[model samples]
Target chain A: MSFNPFYILPELILTAGGILVLLAGLSTRKWEAPGKIKPYSPEALALLTLTGALASSLALLWRPEVVKGVSQFGDMIAVDPMAVFFKIVVLACSIFVVFLAADYFQGIRVHRGEFYALLIFATLAASFLSAATDLIMIYLSLEFLSITSYVLVGWLKQDPRSNEASVKYFLYGAVAAAVMVYGMSIFYGLAATTDIAAIHSKLVSYPPDGSPTHIIFLGLLMMMVGFGFKISMAPFHQWAPDTYEGAPTPVTAFLSVASKAAGFAVVLRVLVSVFTPGVVDWTPMIVALSGLTMTVGNLTALPQCNIKRMLAYSSIAQAGYLLLGVAALRLSPLALPAVMLYLFIYLFMNMGAFAVVTMVSARLNSDDIREYSGLAKRSPASAVAMAIFMLSLAGIPPAAGFVGKFYLFAAALQSGDKTLLYLAILAIANTVISVYYYMNVVRYMYFAKPKSDTPLKPSFAMNMVVGFAAAATIIMLISPEPFIQMAKHSAALLTGTP
Target chain B: MIPLEWYLGLSAALFCIGIFAVLSRRNAIGILMGIELMLNAANINLVALARYMHPHILTGQVFAIFIMTVAAAEAAVGLAIVISVYRNAEHINIDKITTMKW
Candidate 1:
């Protein structure tokens, strides 16, 4: 097979960009005070790198060959509309996170340069993860993402909370990755190939029988445990709240959006491609897991006093909702697109929520919900944006989250399966229960009187990011035709003429 | 040649022990060692399967190599985080490292 460097242009750029940014961090400025090293303006360089990569991904989308999903490098990586779409998502995430961190690090008094380098590296890993077509590619990319995440989570080395979070995250992640690799080894052993397509064909040719049934099930479950940890699915979600609360808020935002997107991308691709629908059906299992995950996530979130922890739990619930689409993928053609659309909208609303958290925390140096009291009186703009985000998260109309949920529930109902319908109803009940906790933040921001009436002022760049995300969220809700159409097209690339 | 089943059985037993050590151990370094054991179990499976099933191809061996490389990297990072955590708390007990909780 001929190697095509053009197929991996985006990844190459990101890799070069990460190294360059790392080098930039090492170079000292001439005007620095004694004993103080002037940090390089990595935020600007990171933004430039991310934009270039994003442009390349968009260019790849326009290529006719890539539209049809071209396999490159001995079928290890796939270049398709779906891959390009996710690359775009992850790149956008990097851009916004860099924006968040650019302003955030100034407030916290931490080293800013290597932080961008790590973020870029994480983006590179996520792009590979969404495009991996072979078992080796999948495992390598997934581990790359995990290892970077472990470091990034602990970047605030001086903070005990941050260090603690990193340890917990690393311990859980290392074990989960080990279990997942074990499962992949089994598949490779049975099929004598590590390529996902080849494994699918082999499994289809010789389906597992009585004795091997246990191995297949065990393999699938173990692998899901690893993916579940990345996406923060329940029963495997013990690390998320702690990690999110302990880590720097900007890192939390990046993990919540881009990392989760990569996890969903791999989960959707592997389960859809490998299992072939009936050989070893895991939909019923997923349905039950989704229900349990959402219920647990919402119920646990209600008692959280820390805003970051609350958002963490809410993100788990959102993952449960996303999994519902995975459950409906075989039954409804719209499921995958709905999932894609939901993730896109989720990036804005959830990231916007975290952006607000970063801003408030930077000022008050607290992540507690009560610290947001009378935020509307202090910062009307941020207060309104937070309200919109909270409402969007609650799936109220005129916010993009409602439209996202509508399509997802529509997919579930279109399945016409009694169990799926019940799952949809359960999701609706979870949504209603979620409204109270989401609104709890809004209540603190609007109704409660502040201990002091000092006005809060977000920086110019922070305002720009929050405004852009808020406007996009409302605009997507009001006119979702283009975004919905794009998601459907991307979904079709994965599910074959969906 | 020894049966592939024998190799697989040993790997499975090793993996189980690894998991037990990871879950049961309280020291951070002990947990990391457990993770290494689990990774090596997978490495054993990969190498054994490659030799028995596909003697002509080197995919499984290559995968085993990559797993070894990744395990080393993970251990490096894991120990670094452990050392950093210890700097703050003066201890490395996993159970006692609870500064942030629900």
Candidate 2:
């Protein structure tokens, strides 16, 4: 028997991380030993475990490029450039989130080990969701992610807000997901296949536009609705700001960046693999949904005062922008790269924003915008980091966010969808509106007066992590060739075009 | 024996009911239950359609099985969250638990 072990690197790293946390919970002896079952000082122990996991994920950077369409487990996984690229992104994101989580758990009553374990497990599931080529695999993987996240969201069980955030999240998430499954069943009924590729092949010539199209259209719409709820797109995005605010900051960061990206990952897969050459008649509906989502998310965000809530609404709006890329799947020269590129830039811009939120909140014990008044006077490096993230998010010049939006709008334009292109331009206008709220923080940080004896110290860890994110944003803006090329290559796997 | 349209109609009705509950339910657990019913409806549709449309194919059955597994996992996490809510607020009614209600 031959051993085929090449495609398991990312999974192995994640599994090892999860097991390490579990073992740490089991093996550690304690000075006071709070409880025999509940590990003592689990925070420090969990932090170390997260560090180890982060290191393992970084280890993937050394592996050779994985081409697309390298299937495993009866065509369960498609280990192409797209999958490999996203796996790395998810992996790297988990590592950063773990760094942010340890502090957030300081006073929380949960076992830190379990939190880290759940984090690893969720990331692993997300990776699976991203790489899954079969419907069964996608559903299974998404379950793994959802369950872990449900627990993580409510990790601070003592806090009513935390519990409420989680409950609302679960209920809404469940409904959308069930709807998605129902839609999938419709596809299964029509195509008689659970493999995405098989279903796509079956769909290709089944009378391009007819009653079948209507039925398939309904199914696809239901499916995207479910995915939309997951990513917290507007109309379906009611749960995000609450959940992001109620969850611990680290968990919020992970949920916003990695989890949303993971969901988008599958959205790409569904569009590219199962509805290749585009779900023609379905495009108009998506464009309209995308337009409404972007417009509503940004417009609502204008009145938010809570920092976390602002970011939450902003994230929803960002998902709308990402949706524009998805809507262009059939319209452009290959929209997959556009999607990948946006996600890549999103990891930096969004995470940097969350990192600033986490760090500032950790020190100030608040998530209110007013609390961030005079951050620049208090902490220069952190202040500057916040500035760059704001600029990037607003899609200002010399930010990766600008380049990403440009590419996506360009794709829509090339797809010859004048309406979508106009919506994309209006999306840019929303970006301008977003700039105001984002800059409000910058203004308070630089202009307002500090109000506390709170020591404003930027440590090596904060500098290293935030600066790394900031530096990445800068590099992607100045010279995004390598990364865009990587995204383009990943795009090829889905579009079947080089 | 029930006709295949009966099963499809029944499944569609169940799904519609699920959607209605999700839209109207105030309690978080109640909403989750609605979602569960909807998923079960999907499973029924998949099995019925598989048996009728492609009598020889097992794909729909397999898909239905996956849906069930996912639903089970979802319930586990969801119930745990309900317990978490009760612990925090001393209330099981999601309507009263507005502290974190978004």
Candidate 3:
């Protein structure tokens, strides 16, 4: 099997860039100027690397072979339109995070280069995860992502909360990865192959009456534990709130949006490719999980005073809504596209919310909701942007999230499955339950009295990220046709069972 | 010759013991050990299944090797984190590390 170098250009770029950033961190010279708003070398290099990778990913989207789906690396990974789209999303997320971190670590005396390098590596892992077509590739890339995240979460070694957060994340992540690998071992035993396509073919070759249905179900359930932990699904979400609250806010944003997207990408790929409808009817299981996940996330989010913790729960609920798209995959043609669209929109809104949180927390050194009182007076631009993000997250009309949710729920309804229909209704109730907490931040920003009248001036980099995210969010709602078409175009995953 | 069922049973028991230790142990290092036990159980399963079921291919054996490598790396990182946590909290007790509510 000859390895094709052209197919993995983005990964190569990220690898080179991560190494370069890590090496750059060893320089002793000061790069920051006293008065000018210039980015240091690590930030500049990371941005350049991400931009290059993003361009390559976008180029892959237009390749005729890639659009049709091309298996690379001896069928360990697939460079399909879906993979390219997710690669783009993940790269864009890293780019925005670099900007967020620039202003975030401005005053802190820490190793900025290592942080950027790890972020790049995490992005690399996420990109690999989204495209992995073999069980080994899946396990390797998922663990790669988790280990990098553990380090990033615990980056502030001196802070006890950061240390605690990293420990919790590592403990949960290691156990989950082990369990997932065990499940993959079972699949290997059953199929005698690691390639997803071969596994699917082997599973389908079993005689129906003598099929090892119970064992297959056990493997599937075990694998979901790892995937569920990544996406913060119910019963596996205990680590999220503490981790989000304790970690630096920029890392929190990256984990919520980028990591969760990668998790969903792999989940959808595995379910659609390896466990096709003829092999295993997983729709019922997905429906139950989707309903339970949203309810748990929304109910837990109600009493959170900490802003980051609240967003953490809200992101979990968002994961549940995303799962609706997966549940409807076999029944509705719109399901995959709906998931793509929601994740794309979520990238903007969630990051925008966190960017604001990062800025506010940097100034006040507080993530408590009460600290946001009269934010409209202190920083009208940020307050308004926060309001836009909050409204969008709550799925209000005229915001991008409403359109995204509309497509997801519409996909579920279009499935014509009764259980999915009930799940969709339950999701709607979860949405209603979620609006109160999301708006609680807004009410404080607009109506509550200010603790201090001093204006909170956001730095230029943060301003750019927040402004770009806000504009993208509103514009996506206004002209959602192109985005929808992009999502539809990118939904052509390579299924093996067909 | 030992049957495949015997190997499968042994691996399952090991995995269950790992889970029990992970849930019951309060020491962070003990939990880490449990995780290692679970990983090794899977390793045993993979290698045994590969030998008995698919002797013609090295897929399961190769996967087991990769799992072992990754497991080692995981342990190193996990121990580093445990050390850092201990430095801050002055103890490695999982129950007492609850600055944030579980």
Candidate 4:
């Protein structure tokens, strides 16, 4: 019944930064000369906001109080360690994304402070999505996230591809959202409460479990339709390739990594927290969907020439692995940790891949795989980073992706679900299919010669993001222990185990 | 003086109409309007159930408010994207916007 504003410090910081950037945009410095030096300007404002968000999220590490479920806004926003941990992850990824966006906007002449403001606004929505424990809150935050993304995907309004991406994304997403809300109403009609914990209690204490199960599953299924659109899971993934390929590269990275991660975060939280496995009649259906999604994503990815579209399919494939984790949600000690770990690892690997795409495109002014024909000779840093991202995405050994996938399959194995094991294997084979396409990019970077002149210089921010994400991708392979430990600790909170 | 089943039936019929709109309309904005109708059906159901069941008045109102907020946000983003696309392609048709086709 009380509001603890401090519990939401990271989101508060980001939202405040959004406001500051909005106000700062109106007060541009004017100079008598053509190009005079204006200190404390655009770059400083963006970097300052990014730094503030990072510091606030990092501050969450020491707040042991919130780890134990400190409620704020009448328990509407929870500040548990799970939320805090993912907030840190989201903040780190957002900071990296904004850094890339800074470079991207400068290059593309979209240096409006509104771009920074929207990035912050989107991050705010992501944080809310992470912390929501009620259907009302989740729906609102999801909309917040979607609208911001719709704008960001269409940031370059003059480009036909950008406009098309935004329109398609918005239309598909609007239908999904409606379906999701109807699903929520179904649950409310059956259970009489929207709070996740209350709904769980209602179901657990209900007389006829079958009746409640039917109603709740309908709600969950409808909700999945919405989230499936967001995360680009198969059958619902028809929007992904177009949107990802058409959006700006920086926004593409955000869409693939942060936005998709946020979508899974909501799915995991709602499914694991509200509806136990017994309540839902379709863990196998989920497992089957996982199998189909990975296979479809990889098989389609193998034959693509446009690098961005290939990555789009590849992202869908990654969504399958996350779906496997969702199917294995209630399986074992490893179940929750595996999903948390995969999401965390995916942040590094996926964003790194987009960084490579962005870097190559910036240098070559093309997103065609052929443009990467001689990246090794021109920019070995990007080439090696691209290779690492590709290998990691393919679930190659000695990388975080492999470790994450192993934990997921091991959890499925622990659950003793034969169908899920089949999914795990199919996912592995899809990884192999993915390897061919990923290596094609690598082959283009190393083997074939560039069809045109390669750039002599890489943008400093691109260099920073690539190097940072590449290092994280490798380092998590070595000391994945600490991150894994944190993930386990966080997941245990949901199960009330640790 | 409509019976409860009739009210529920009307809302369900409205929901079906909304689904029909979504399936048939090629204009992105028209599809968005369909989505709005579907949400409104769900809202109608909420109010009906509240009126019939009468277990809690506050929860239904809160839900209605939340749905409105979601509908508003959806409309804003949906229409903005539609206008942006119309400006670019000079048409509101979803069929012609298949540049990313396989």
Best by lDDT: 3
Off by over 4 Å in 1: A28-40, A207-211
How does candidate 4 score on lDDT?
0.80
Scored against the true structure, residue A392 in model 4 reaches a CA lDDT of: 88
Worst 10 residues of 4 chain A by lDDT: A29-38
Per-model tally of clashing residue pairs: 0, 3, 0, 0
DockQ of each candidate's interface versus the true one? 0.89, 0.76, 0.79, 0.75
Candidate 3 residue-wise lDDT at A82: 89
State the weakest 10-residue window (summed lDDT) of model 2 chain A: A30-39
The candidates, ranked best first by lDDT, are 3, 1, 4, 2
The residue pairs found clashing in candidate 1 are: none
DockQ order of candidates, best first?
1, 3, 2, 4
TM-score of chain A of each: 0.96, 0.92, 0.98, 0.95
TM-score (C-alpha) between model 3 and the true structure: 0.98
lDDT of 2 by residue, A67-152 (tens): 53567787887767677677767777877786676545444456666777788889889888888888778778877787788888
| TM-score, chain A, candidate 3 | 0.98
Any idea what lDDT model 2 has?
Answer: 0.78
Off by over 4 Å in 2: A1-3, A27-65, A208-211, A277-279, B100-102
Clashing pairs in 2: A67-A80, A68-A80, A331-A415
Top-scoring candidate (TM-score): 3
The CAPRI quality class of candidate 2 comes to: medium
Which residue pairs come into collision in candidate 4?
none
